[model samples]
Target: MKILLVGEYNRTHWNLKRGLQTLGHEVLVIGFRDGFKKVDIDIEIKDPLSSRFLKKVRVLIYKFFKIDLLAHSVKKQILSKKDELSGYDVIQLVNESPFLIDLKCQLEILKWLINWNDKTFLLSTGPDYVSVMHAYNKKFRYSILTPYFEGKITNKNFQHVLSYFSPEHKKIHAYLTKTIEGIISNDLDYHIPLIDHPNYLGMIPHAIELSQLHYKTPNLDNKIVIFHGINSKNYYKKGNDIFEQALDLISVRHKNKIEIITVTDLKYVDFIKSFDKAHILLDQVYAYDQGFNALEAMAKGKVVFTGAEQEWLEHYNLEEDSVAINALPDAQNIADKLEWLILNPNKIIEISKNARAFVETHHDHINCAQHYLKKWST
Candidate 1:
């Protein structure tokens, strides 16, 4: 299949591209740098507001006018490459707003994609009308929006997720359901909302290239090292704030027992290396499954405190706190877990080995690609 993946998030599409190519499919990804992560892509859509000045200007305009000044220009960048984007056997959008531009402009791109491609589908790997609506309706016990409901994240900080409820975005959602071949989810977080929908193909485990990841049994000879990496943009949503509070408590209690490293918004490769010496990593709190970053860290045998909810555990047929620590939405609870790991250092080694083994068993890139292939063929 000549697959053209339209967007990326945390190297999602790039890793999929690798898997598909390994299976003898010609796959290309055209998307932005995913902010500071800077994942590789065949065609890059340069972000107009990457600079501080432009971002401040964009924010100011939206503050009063609720407008995106560079929306048209961003749209033009994609449309200009219509020839390169056209005639693919399959085209998959990684999110509802593939370009992360205005919804009105996204529709124009969708229309072009629908007309030019042989088969067009939506990959429910990120926020969309379905998942956002699911969370808003209190279907999930917790989600990325949980912080907002608890009054942790302000309205301005969460404007992007809130946009899915807009009239224009709703129109795009309706059109996608009517026209796309199907929607495939990335993990349990997205899978729950898409269950039983007519156009829903199914959930596929996220593809992780284990070859690029190295596992080391964390050396427990010295002070336990804890690494916390945060993206400033997703600080509240990813529950980094909660993690920080928990870490604060742990630092005070075990000041001599543990060594903590905290870094923000480093590039993807740099971020991976930034925590290379740590025994544990603090991933997000509001997800039901491991994201790319968490999975990568797990592949490196780092016990990650991320979403290891009941659904995830049941789906993977695992025990609670066996492979990874399920980071809930409470700082005190997280602090307790951190303290447990600090005192019981042997459990970290057990969980770290389990984490690496789990990824190797379920997230091998080629196996994930085969799952995608079967669904796409259907």
Candidate 2:
């Protein structure tokens, strides 16, 4: 089968392409480098004039002539590569707004792509209209929007959620859902909101190339190394403040027993390499299931502090506290958990072994690709 994957989220499409190829299917991916993270893609849609000076000029041009230079450039690129995009057996969009363009322009582009493919699917890799609405409606116990509703987060942090619920974005989501053949989620966070949709396909575990990750039993004889990578832009959204506050208290108590390493705005490759000696990785606290970062660390035999929510645990038939430690969005709870791990170093090795085993059983790239193949075929 020939497949085309649109958009890249934390190398999700890149790994999926590898998995599909391993299963003897031809796959192609097209997306942006997504800034400093530098996600892989076959064809990149460039915004050449996106620098600070150029952006100011673009705003002036748009205000005077109603010409959106950035959107125009992306649209031109898509049309230029129209031939390569045609005749695919299946085409999957990572999200509703896959490209960095005006919503109207994005909808127009997607309409053209829909006509070129036999089947089109949407991936719920990040928050979408339905998911945000669900969170706002209190459909789930807690979500990324919990803090926003509780007044614990700033208005800036809530803007993304507001955008999804906007009339313009709602139109875009409705159009995409109506046009796409099916919608699928890769994690519990997305799966929850999509559960009731008639065209919703079941969630699939993230595809991780197990062979590429090297597993090492961490040496916890001296100080146990704990690492946290911060994306400054979404610090509050990701509950980084909670983690930092917790770590601060824990550090004061166990000054000599633990080594805490916190990095800000590192590139993807450097970020992963920086944690080589870490026994535990502190990931997002607001997630219902582990995201790409936590999954990658788990693949490398590192115990991760991430979302191992009850729903996710029950889905895999996992017992409580078996594999990954569940990190809540409370400073005291997070601090207590970290302190427990520091005091009981032996549990770290056991959890590390369990983490690797869990990834092998559920997230192997080849197996996940096969699952997708079957779903797409249906």
Candidate 3:
């Protein structure tokens, strides 16, 4: 089957596309290149005019013309790419491209694309509406109370706490069901109403698979190496301060026995490479489930520490303190778990074995890609 994938083409898309190709499907990706071309995928780059000078010019030009024209410029670009849009058995629009934000225009384009060929599938990755709103807004200082602020809200303290809640914007929930044929969510709790639709696909928990090169076991003679995923851009999302506090606590007692590393400063490949030295990977305590980095650690046969949420644990077939050591956002809780692992060699080995097995079964790219193929065929 010939397939067209449209999105940013990040690591997730790269793996999915490659997996589809491995299944004997012709897959072509079209979107912002974003330095992902080195991996092997046909790309069509469409970057918006983002220069500060150009933005200022656009704002001033809009004062005399119209605001909706800015939205139309995006539509024109989408139309230009329609030439390559033909000859595909399936066309999957992974997420909201700039053209899709104009709800009416996107609907019209969808109709247009289908008119050219009927075999087209629109699959949205995740809604993430509230997160986008918060990122775009300038106020509230964009502070996250806990890593779990997965819940949406304006402010914890405000003049009219109840009034600030947006029922209209919250109604964006309905947008998820608007016209999409399928929905894919990283979070099981995203709450889309189309799960019963024959085409509805559910969330897959994040995990790592054994890479081409297997991960080597730690020697234990060296101090425990911890990769702190502190990012300067998404500091709030990553809980930078929380990680720092955990590091400080680990320093006081196991200063000589613990080695901390941050990935933000390194190249992406190099960042993933540093995990080779890690004995234990600390996942975000506040996140509902593990993320990419945590899963990578699991793929490497290293024990990972994460939240104790029932759904997360169940996904891995783990109980309270079994496969992964669950810790809260508190420094003391994280330190205690780390210290316990340091003292108990047997427990680490047991969980390490379970972690690798879990990732192999769930997150293997070929398995995941086959699952998607079944979705298309069915």
Q: On residues 264-315, what C-alpha lDDT tens digit does candidate 2 reach at each position? A: 9887888778888999899998888989989999988788989999999999
Answer with 1 or 2, whichever has the higher lDDT.
1
| lDDT of each residue in 1-378, candidate 1, tens digit only | 899998899888888889999989999899888878888889998876778899889879977987876676777887899899889999999998887777787798789887988988899988999999999898999999898999988987898999999999999999999999899998999999999999999988899999999999889999999999999988989999999999999888999999999999899879979989999999999999999889999999998999999999899999999999999989999999999988898899999999999999999999999998899889
Q: In candidate 2, which residue ranges exceed 4 Å CA deviation? A: 59-66, 152-157
Q: Please give the ranking of all candidate structures by lDDT, highest first, separated by commas.
A: 1, 2, 3
For model 3, residues 147-260, the per-residue Cα lDDT tens digits are 324442334332122221345333433443454456555443332233455545666443223565375656677677776755453454455566678778878988887788
The models' CA-based lDDT, in order, is: 0.90, 0.87, 0.58
lDDT (Cα, 0-100) at 222 in candidate 3: 65
The residue pairs found clashing in candidate 2 are none
Error of 3 at 166 (Å): 9.0
What TM-score fits each model?
0.96, 0.96, 0.74
- Clash count in backbone of candidate 1: 0
Candidate 3 ranges beyond 4 A from true positions: 33-41, 44-77, 96-178, 186-199, 205-209, 265-267
Candidate 1 — what's its lDDT? 0.90
Off-target runs (Cα >4 Å) in candidate 1 are 56-67
Candidate 2: worst 10 consecutive residues by lDDT? 153-162
